[model samples]
Target: MPEFSRLEPHVVAEILRICETMLDEFDQSYKHSFRLTDVHGFGDFDSAQQLAADYRRKAAGTPESARERMQQFIDALTQLRD
Candidate 1:
């Protein structure tokens, strides 16, 4: 197995933390507006809100999957570092 130290763990942690924080913020925003049944059509805001809600649900339920994907990205970086 490749040594994990090929990648800087702190950098990995920071990137993951930032992604998780952004996703959490997205979840909160979606939860706050998921039930909005009306919008003035100024950007299809209603549909956008619904889409965001769906994405938030998916993201919340599959956070591990997201993290795994991020890990793969980090591994790719490690390859580059090597």
Candidate 2:
């Protein structure tokens, strides 16, 4: 891992902010998925299965996406600082 301690406070703050936004978006997506599942039918196994699949997609996809994004931001900021 990069020595984050060497990074500027503002850079650290921005990283934190980006992470917070990603978390918020993930939470919203999860809630929306649950709501959609409920709307289709509370006891519908198929709907629940679909939701599970979607969640799996999200879970599998989001971290790498977020990491790339954060790295891009870090690279850009580091370049600017340099």
Candidate 3:
């Protein structure tokens, strides 16, 4: 596999944090039946769908990058293990 170097660890952490927050909001919104009383205009299905898609894209990208990092880490660890 190709080496992974574009994303720094701190940037990945930040992205993961944002994705977690968005996922939590999406979960809460669904549980409450998309109640507008608590979230104003953000309770609509379309808004939620868009946010979900955006979050998914970011999350997938982050995971792919992280996977590369993790593979590299594993390879390095394996060298020690052997």
Clashes per candidate (backbone, < 3 Å): 0, 0, 0
Question: What is the lDDT of every predicted structure here?
Answer: 0.54, 0.55, 0.51
lDDT of 2 by residue, 4-42 (tens): 558688987888777666666655555454343223333
CA shift of 35, model 3, Å: 7.5
| lDDT digits (tens) for residues 5-61 of candidate 1 | 564889978877776665666455555443342333345677777776565554444
- The parts of candidate 3 lying over 4 Å away from their true place are 1-5, 34-82
- Identify the candidate with maximal TM-score: 2
lDDT string for model 3 (1-82, tens) is 7776587888878876765665565455434532322323345699786776554454334545333344444555444333
List runs of model 1 lying over 4 Å from the truth: 1-6, 38-82
- Give the local distance difference test score of model 3: 0.51
Candidate 2 TM-score over all chains jointly? 0.39
lDDT for residue 33 in candidate 2, whole number 0-100:
48
Q: Clashing residue pairs, candidate 3?
A: none
The collision pairs in model 2 are: none
lDDT of 1: 0.54
